[model samples]
Target: MKWTYTIQTEGLTVEQLLRDEWRLSKKQVHELRMAKGILDADETPIRWNEPLAAGTPVVIQLADTVSPHVPEPNPDVSIVFEDDHLLIACKPKGMPTHPNDPGQSGTLLNGVLGYVHAHGGTYAEHVHRLDQGTSGLVLFAKHPVVKNALDRMLEDRQITREYLAEVEGNIQKNGGTITAPIGRDRHHPTRRHISPSGQPAITHYSVTARRKGTTELRLTLDTGRTHQIRVHLASIGHPITGDELYGGAADSAGTYKLHAFRMTFIHPFTGKKLTAQN
Candidate 1:
């Protein structure tokens, strides 16, 4: 994969440009140096100590081999949106966002890296994360500046996220807001629960459909937290179907019925509104 960057300021060397301006890790810099992927705009070879001036463009090409941390890319991963700056993909159920163990593989990140490699992109920078069982849209930033900008937008809640979920039992209210504090479960290391000392979480939901034993809901989050929706819904006696970890009833579908259905946000680079859905 090849990436091009135009030098905006003067007096920076090639090495400084890669490390400070572009935010490439030391390992990546060393690899690029070894591969001689760093070159002038004219495609001429350049040394690490070469001085760069304003308007000079430098290109960095990534090696074809997949990173050791990620598994081989699988082409079957679904693509929802793609542009020069962003990639939105629908993560399949049962795929973790990233590998969590030494021998772990087959994660969404691995698949994304594979796609990027195949398509001539440089890297995968995730804007947000989803649980393993939740099938939904996942955003990937193509560069560092875009990733940084989106991170700020997420921190300010400028990104709008909508989800669809099927929960056990009928809800008494057609629409309501759930304000609760969520924190890590003291007993179970990987679970979350409501607690007084936890971070504040707010969920707004409207009943959309009713199955024989479950109600489908359109849910919006005011604050994103680990297991916020599951914990809040279970606290209100409507845990998601098939989510036994949170005391939910078994689902006939054999999979947790939750999907990140929609995301709307302003484009950081183009200053235009964008919406992506599953």
Candidate 2:
């Protein structure tokens, strides 16, 4: 489709015309140039070096066809809790919070934006994070005060997080604590491992049920670290079932059986204790 606009300036160069009259930015102009979308006032494709008179009428002929390689992303989200100052949601496993790679576009943020747009659009922000493969209750704030308060609580260990997981071995005791330091795996870029020289991490585990071959445990994190449950459990010889990273079964489809079961925190705005269990 060709859109025509009258040139107000009589003899400015085509570059100058685009510079002043284009609604999009200069970078957009360069992108349009790359797309071969820029044209002359005479409806001809103009060279980059071409100059134009100020008053020349410009015609920008855009193609009707859409680019096949570029896919349009739709925004979406699932709301777990909502109030004047915060919105909480359960992030599904295997979806990213934000776009990291070209393959990841439609994300939790996109969905939240769509939700905001639908509900009269309030000021909202994500306060914390969960890995792409972890599913859990995550909080978002409508006010910076709420966010800052939650950050303080998290820092102070006031927020309690409990998780459930099925691991490969039979956890001998009913409950035990793993006081290991966690650090990035030196050999693997995509995983975290326990090391003597890493940051302090405390993971408390209580055996919930014992399957003949596998043991299910409730893991409460004393200090949240990257892959703390999987790493700590594996450090003690019980890698999470299906967690292929720190060594678990790849044969079963139900591997890496970790679930965020409960979260406890005082309401940032109301000053009341609030708990969400999933």
Model 2, global lDDT: 0.69
Once superposed on the true structure, which residue ranges of model 1 sit more than 4 Å away at CA? 1-68
lDDT, each prediction: 0.81, 0.69
Error of 2 at 205 (Å): 1.0
lDDT of 1 by residue, 71-90 (tens): 45776578888887788988
Mind sharing the TM-score for model 2?
A: 0.68
What local lDDT score does residue 103 receive in model 2, on the 0 to 100 scale?
Answer: 48
Backbone clash total, candidate 1? 0
The Cα error of candidate 1 at residue 39, in Å, is 17
Model 2, 184-208: lDDT tens per residue? 8778887988778999999998999
